[model samples]
Target: MNRLFPVWRRCAAVWVTGGLAAVLSVHAYAQAPTQRPAQSATQSPTAWTTSWSTALQEIPRIAEPPPLYQAPAVAGRTVRQIIVPTLSGTTTQLRISNRYGTRPLTIAGVTVARSAAGAAIEPGSASVVTFGGKREVVLGPGMEMDSDAIPFKVTRGAPLTVSVDAGSDAVMQAWHRIAGRVSYVSSEGRHAGDIPAAAFNVRFTQYAWITRLAVSGEHKGGLVAIGDSITDGLRSTFGADRSWPSELSRRLAAAGATPMAILNTGISGNRLLSGSVCYGDSLESRFEHDAAELPGVHTVVVMIGINDINFSSMPARRGLDCDTPHKVVSADDLIAGYRRVIATAHRHGLHIVGGTITPAALPPAREAIRLKVNEWIRDGRAFDGVVDFDKALRDPAHPDRLKTSFDSGDHVHPSDAGYAAMALAAEGVVPGAKR
Candidate 1:
């Protein structure tokens, strides 16, 4: 009876041990697939993305505006078919600004669509834009709002037309005056989602309220061109994106190199040291906002000071009162301003390339200062690199004047060919750009 009891106990212990091992193995097998999916969700490829932006600024109302600077205001009406160029991306957004408005700017509705023809949208491509998931947005004075991302695919260099209906409360609005492109305005109706070009009758050359278009994609960074009228595409064909910076963007894309977006922050009649109500803020004051703070921006190309030198000598030419202070600045003063720009850029970890002031028909006094400044830009080593714009656009026969072929007949600003040359000269120095 004792031997039988010992055998029974041994068999019972073996059976219990085997049963526990089998239970643990089944539990581990059940957990294996669940763990793998969680790991993969964390390692998703969609995590890598960037924002490419088009920077905008306020256009101060001028007292005696020229024919081209006459951009009308928006109130109780729909501004339809404002065409804008953007960098390539899978998703898109809109930035509306009221930075200089005295009252709250109320936007009733907005829409974006693929541009089909003049003031027309492609079929079934229009998307409603919202702010925080709401269609109506009210921006307080000196404020900017970004719309929620819409699932819209955009190709490089393709134009998108944005439509807006500014409610009756919107008054004293800001604008991009020298849009260099055509936009259509409707006579008091909410045609933001319409597809017909016939609904818009009043043709204009300005972008109102809309500040920037941001896109999501894979890109290294952005390149910003900060300058005066020359960089503003003054003489380039209307509605054609022939600005030097635009040309540079096309060149970069054609090379099939690493992706980089270009942002142009040029304002016509702008000066580097002085801020006039009509010419926007001075480069010294606006540097941080325009050049340094831009999203995905790492390289800045600067070309200014011609207006600083020219306007100082002839303030009356632009109908300015000669009594304006700080009109005349020496070469040293201009160089000092350049240094300040460099310091600000460096502090923000931006790689700045200085562009030599292009030649124009100037008085000897102004020309001498331009030469001195150019010499310092080339030899002083104050910038990360230098783009010799003077050498590129100046006539070898007469170094003080613009090449006759490149001149836009005003002895200032560049023709289409000249703008192309400027782009070529600077392409090699753009940060992360493949030369």
Candidate 2:
């Protein structure tokens, strides 16, 4: 294993800002993220705060892909999507990412309006989304471009509708799969400006080219939750927002303490140190763009490494195995990965909260690794804070399995109650996130 941070040389000196305190990492990075180093953001109330964001994965190009992974064709058509922002503001920006596209993506027009119903927008709230004052945009491959700030009123938790009319050559090569929320796609021609739901005849549960919705307002800062399926709200009630992050967001909003937008960057089947043909890049490699450098992000909560510890043990399938590379990893390797992630966050002046890995009903050997990782999370004190999700959802008697009431039937992910419990434990670690 590479010594990403062969030696942990964390300095005791720390600075506190906006209810968030962060340590400065004056160390060497042996193995850094695949992207460029994380840049420090000038986070403030007036800066662009990412209120809604998604982590993207490349659509598999195998012989056949599951219907869920098959991206809808968008050429010469308007696609309307619904998103509920977590922060309220008077001005907002929309970001379009062609991060994984093989070719340039062109958009003819876009409009933003408050969502009135499924695929329908409020009659008068439609606002044009532009880039440099131009309604049309040609986004280059691997590029992420943000629309000019549009003066639109938005309230926290209110669903906002975004309609896009990608030019005749547009197609989805990258998407945030498993979006739990429904998005509408038009049948033939441009309907981005349509007020009726008849044009948007198709519905899908994945986010397309759109990447982020940011706001400028009196927000403390934003929190990013990055990791695997549990963090991605898998198996939870669709469109119900029962993920631990969503639950935590609701709890904080109700408590009126440390009010900040929470962004979910977790991809199902995501690994800490490995990649998947369908699961996106390794969380460690994508951390810079997905979490560290996100606009207005002051804190991060990571519940990862289970995949890294388990993928190696699974047998290869006869068909297209997304879990191929199946790289072997140990507790030491995961700890090293966490250290690198921690250092990256600190360099960006963000507080990182370590999440103790949850139980997955693994065999004794694999179970031991999970326990060791949790021990380090709870006692290593390397992160800014720690959230003991393992303790929160673990069966008191079994000690290594999910509590019956908290199991999401798979015994791997968490149930709605389990996720809520996780949010309760997470509240204590987030600065000022009181119950």
Best by TM-score: 2
In candidate 1, which residue ranges exceed 4 Å CA deviation?
1-70, 81-86, 315-326
How many clashes does each candidate structure show, in the order listed? 0, 0
Candidate 2 segments whose C-alpha is farther than 4 A from its true place: 1-46
Backbone clash pairs for candidate 2 read: none
Model 2 residue 328 CA deviation (Å) reads 1.8
Per residue, candidate 1 scores C-alpha lDDT tens digits across 313-404 of: 55454554422444889999999999999877766666677889998978788889999999898778677667788888998888888898
TM-scores for all predictions: 0.84, 0.90
